[model samples]
Target: MGIDDITKKAQEFLGDDKVKDALKSEQAEGVSDKLLDGVADAANKVTGGKFADQIDGARDAADKSVGNE
Candidate 1:
């Protein structure tokens, strides 16, 4: 799928509540990096690196949407 598709799917899977929780838990001093790394890794595994760029974009979008950016 495309970037938009990936982004929408990620947002749906994460949901507002989980995204908020992640943002809250990760917005702290040093946890965001680790959280984002985990997100990227999960995305990579899910997509098997076929849509790496889209996955990265979706992760960033999710982060920005939840105020982690």
Candidate 2:
């Protein structure tokens, strides 16, 4: 399959209720937040903190997508 095909499949899987529920559980325990924080920190370091705000916003959006506030 192509990159688009893999992306589409991933989107479909993430859209499933079961998958969402699992993500929610992970978020509840702070797992996703920690992971996102690490990612954002790395991204900020890569760009010398120039895009920190945008990276943080993306991190928050990703966290919310998992089903939490």
Please report the candidate that would top lDDT against the real structure: 2
Q: Alpha carbon lDDT of residue 43, candidate 1?
A: 80
**What is the lDDT for 11 in model 2?**
96
Candidate 2 residue-wise lDDT, 1-69, digit = tens: 999999999999989988878877845538777788899999999999999889999998888866455
lDDT of 1 by residue, 1-69 (tens): 899999999888777776657655645424655577698998899889998898788777656644334
Supply the global lDDT for candidate 1.
0.71
What residue runs in model 1 are displaced by over 4 Å at the alpha carbon? Answer: 1-29, 66-69
> What TM-score, over all chains together, does every model reach?
0.44, 0.76
Clashes of each: 0, 0
User: In model 2, which runs have C-alpha deviations exceeding 4 angstroms?
Assistant: 26-29
Q: How many residue pairs clash in model 2?
A: 0
